[model samples]
Target: MLRVRQWLFAASFFVCGASLASTACPNFFVNGSNPSIDASLTTRTTEVCHTEYVLLASGVTKGPLYSAQHITAAQVAGADSISRTGSFHQETAIPAADRSQTSDYTNSGFDRGHMTPAGDESTIDSEKESFSMANIVPQDHKLNTGEWAKIEAKVRDLATNLGEVYVVTGPAFDPDNTPTIGKDQVAVPQYTWKAVYEPGKGAAAYLCQNDDSITCDVVSLNDIKTLSGVDPFPALSSSDHANPISLPLP
Candidate 1:
């Protein structure tokens, strides 16, 4: 059954309150710039700004081409309720023709992988907004349930230790045109990449295969920019860029 994941962690810092005070989420979308990179294939794309995260959606791909968000341990804590907030739903903000339908993943042997995970949102609205199809990608079920999930948890752990974090995650479509799923021809990404930045500390990037092998590696942000042309946060200081981070998932 598809259900929300539970999180348990100890606060190294003082728990000032039961939840994070409502504050503005950080803008990680390169100064509110459009997130589209591959314009040739992305004929109809839109930027769907949710409460906590922003998604660059592609109608051609039937899914989000990219997503960005601010993550914090306290925010995760506040959102991790015993009950799930929302089920999967089509995004009405975009035209129906420009959105992926719930039926797209049905019996497709793939999972509706969330770029900005529902668990990362601190409020019901944000959590519910996460279910919009514009923020989903067709990913291998094994990877979704395995290493990717582990990596997300580890990110939360890092946020807990570091205070706050910014992340940009998206699919890496094949150069030879990715495979399709469902009748809508939703593109199945061959690989996925996640860019992470923590204020005052350092930044790291991770690339992982979308298969069941659980093979993922850290790379340089410039490498990602060169390969994928995705410069998630342009305003970030250059000094914060760190060498390849080796964070092995348990």
Candidate 2:
């Protein structure tokens, strides 16, 4: 059936080493556009064997970047157990006063949403490391668990189907109208965007409103830059790609 075919694709991809050439990890910022609102923020980059992540440090919060892994059926089957091993924690690599904490999300009405979902990680250690504060943002509870979550799942599906995929996802803020939560005043993003890319398939970009109501669009990379004010995956921008079709939330 379909499951067998998927497993066969996964096995063949790993066996022939075909995935390695096309799925190289990407850099933190696409074309030198930092995600910080203030000048004082620091940036941190991390490598976890099969994954690469970057933390663009802001005063109270940081933005994280991760490329989705070319996962196998075995990894997918064991993901749940690995994910349960650790909880979110502050990243010690940054100064204590600068990093976000679990306390910052306490009663903040928003969730400590992960830019890189645990599902995309190939190992337990990588999944645990994903809990670092630098990889989180103040996300609306509804959207965090809703359409955004759906998109994360879709990325995983793409990883399985395309053999390899890289995704750039993070928060987008309107500086003039920024919102804050908790005592540390972590900024809540007004919008969030994700761009999914495969070697031969070009790329698809998504934008979500980050609110209770589910409003999102799949748009061109050009549109994504205009809406989010950041250019993601600049190298792939000129690839032959189709425009995004709208998705209506049920």
Candidate 3:
């Protein structure tokens, strides 16, 4: 029954997009990329410890991969979720290769929290894909499912306001590669994110490493800044990653 309702929601969203094809795609990015922008094509898959993470095509696993969509869906800031998953850029995460091996579970017990979330998706299929195990990981219950999810929801609203722009999100690495787990059920790392937004640009980005949450981890927003002054969408530069300042709105 729940599955049927979800599919119905997804189908309706698809119809709405097709119905509103005349709407324009907006773009927003204040200023420009900082001089130190890494330009490493942050859009592609990146590793979050145990292994660099990337979106893989259905039924295909291993090696280099990218999400199903070249673009990511972003929402605007608001008290509630504005544009949910129907935007459809969100993708699922893959499971660890081996749990027995610490290195295999390199992200041992780490949750594969999404840069973009399924609940934030605008359509049902988009949301369904989010449920795929490929896009999951052991997460710190607190961060992955709580506040962090809130930020993901805001990104969707931000995108709704801006129109269209590039987005690239993943985890914030601790040069040392350390992932912290929650009370045997959640994972909490240095940070989780929904980075990227041009205020007026409909585009935004998100990134987060998995932790140890039995369910999805929920980290609240502390309003972290994007000190890099460059877009992590195309690629985050070493300098930008190193210089994260304050979030634009906060």
Candidate 4:
């Protein structure tokens, strides 16, 4: 029954390129429009573009508000041919005061989670760039290695099967009592989310709490906007924002 509804939505929906202004790395986004963060979330931000992805790094959070990527089946195949470097470093492109240091996550009891997974990068340069701290957040070790890992793999599989997909990933902090870590005071998000747009098909997001409990859900894009204060896909039609296509979960 759910599959029927999803197929119907896919059959009827058509996504057109948005005419919004382009970012420094416009190709990474669905319609060249970078994800916009609400002023209340954080006022200071820098746009950092990498070889394979682009992100909005927040000075207040000392991490990425969101990272965007355009993935293709051929890219996934190439990424699979490479080896994991596990090389993590601070992004020199971001202002020193606003960026997180490797030391900030050291002994802080959190993993430096990548908004765009290393496995998604096809070249050695891109894989290394994936390690930049600007694309990272202080995430729970258990959640990062467990369910979140599964989610990343699932998206990669989707790219392999769907030919192409646009992805935006980021964190959501609690307004009143956000936690901080290390000397830089890097903010720890309460929840992390990954939104996927299968062009001409449908869109949906996987949202999970950054905790040992590993709670997660498949939600509408509007739900993500309401919770995170960022509309990841501003170009998608209102109906697409309101409706969530079913996604296979691990």
Candidate 5:
């Protein structure tokens, strides 16, 4: 997640708090500006922002990543998918090709995936916006559209059930050559599945799918792996777990 205050938001900060806050959330982010908070989890370099559902890929430091749309330094056509606050970012090589130049997309056979996926966003606009060069990772198309997408959907439901969710996601590698995006048409994640949570009732949850292709058991497991916490201030060291976030007043 990210945080920022544009000229349009200049007066809102003082009316409320010093700065907006957000954390590594459970859902995919699009047109991502800046959440009020930052995240605590850390991976290597660039891939940091490519974390599961959050972006902390600051080249200079290791901390919660503001939306590339929020920071001025992070701007490029399709580099970031959104321009709302301007913090959207992606790491696209100008050539958009691998050394082979055949099509890094198919040559490797690993799908160019989004750490913070697009379909995982609430609106198509947001999804389209987050579809940037920075958020892509080499993933198995099956995993992305299959379980990975389910996991992301679960993250979104978590935000809905718990008011706001701070999510962080990325490849599960201990370390490896951060995957590159070859000159292949960017793949959009398929929303074949979904997850729902009713925290107001308790810690109950459920997962559903649009297609009869994936399994329910595995989807829940992956969702748990990526998002298993109740942190109100996820931006503060990722250790600040509060009561499950509360949903917006109904």
Candidate 6:
């Protein structure tokens, strides 16, 4: 069923109301509000910004807790003309001890999955930035190339159809027993999620396990918060968080 265990926790870490506009990289978020992570779940995090996306890179996980992007019809059209150059590399801005190196995934079984996909970038520089290890996670090869790819494509299609959309993609780790890869011990997440919000419309999320089973679900924004300990859409109304719109699955 591809289910994620629900964790009951306080919403103390959430940043909302008037303070949203002051969040770092506010432009990439919905209503100018950045996603908030539960304090208990965060550790040694750094905010890394790029031309097309922004992310909260976690030292503990050696990867992004979430990568956020603002997509528009114009950007999507522009991206169509750009060629993907898979130049994955470490994020130099992040402290060396906290950032992931390309060598970590060199012989690892998992793929260097991108949170903000290169296909979403409109310019060559943006596409290159999308390959930063800070915006990556250890993902199952099959899941990354198959279902996850379709999900990314669907989000791009939605942006084209809806004119614009806000997206936040991230990984969810089991706090008690997160697996690791390479000398850096990059945490391998148990699940990966993507939340999408259309201005003046509503929001929804897609949740999938990081396994070869290929199962995934369309869940509410609130469901994502409970599973990930991060509210991807802090500016959305309670009603919007509670109700999830249908999204096509792979």
Best by the TM-score measure: 6
TM-scores for all candidates? 0.81, 0.72, 0.41, 0.90, 0.39, 0.92
RMSD of each: 11.2, 11.7, 15.6, 6.8, 14.6, 3.3
lDDT of each: 0.69, 0.58, 0.34, 0.84, 0.34, 0.85
Q: Order the candidate numbers by TM-score, best to worst.
A: 6, 4, 1, 2, 3, 5
Name the runs in model 3 displaced over 4 angstroms: 1-112, 175-190, 199-231, 235-250
Q: Which pairs clash inside model 6?
A: none
Better of 4 and 5 by lDDT: 4
Question: Could you give candidate 5's per-residue lDDT for residues 1-250 as a string of tens digits?
Answer: 0111121133222222223344344243322333332122222323223222344443322112222212111212222344333233444422223111224455666555555556444334555545554455455656667665657655554554445433333322111122333443332222222222232232211222212344333223122222321111223322122222222210
User: Which 10-residue span in candidate 1 carries the lowest summed lDDT?
Assistant: 1-10
Query: Roughly what TM-score does model 4 have, to 2 decimal places?
Result: 0.90
Candidate 3 overall lDDT versus native = 0.34
Those runs of model 5 whose alpha carbons end farther than 4 Å from true positions after fitting are 1-103, 176-250
Between prediction 2 and prediction 5, the one with superior TM-score is 2
Per-residue CA lDDT of model 6 for 1-250, tens digit only, reads: 4245333232223322322224567899887889877765566878888988999888889999899999999999999998988698889988999988888998899999999999999999889999999999999999999999999999999999999999999987766678999999999998899999988878999988899988778888887787777889998899999999877776
Candidate 3 residue-wise lDDT at 44 = 32
> Which pairs clash in model 4?
none
For candidate 2, the lDDT comes to 0.58
Give the alpha carbon lDDT tens digit for every residue of 1-250 in model 1: 0110000011112112111111133465544433335335446867777878887777877887678887777887786653566789989988877777779899988899998888787888788899998888988889888888888888878777877788888876655557888777888886777888766656777777788877777766654544454555555555444354455454
Shift in Å, residue 138, candidate 1: 0.8
Clash count of each predicted structure:
0, 0, 81, 0, 40, 0
> For model 1, what is the alpha-carbon lDDT of residue 63?
84
lDDT, residue 18, candidate 5: 24
Q: Residue 84's C-alpha lDDT in candidate 3?
A: 40
Count clashing pairs, candidate 3: 81
Q: Identify the leading candidate in terms of lDDT.
A: 6
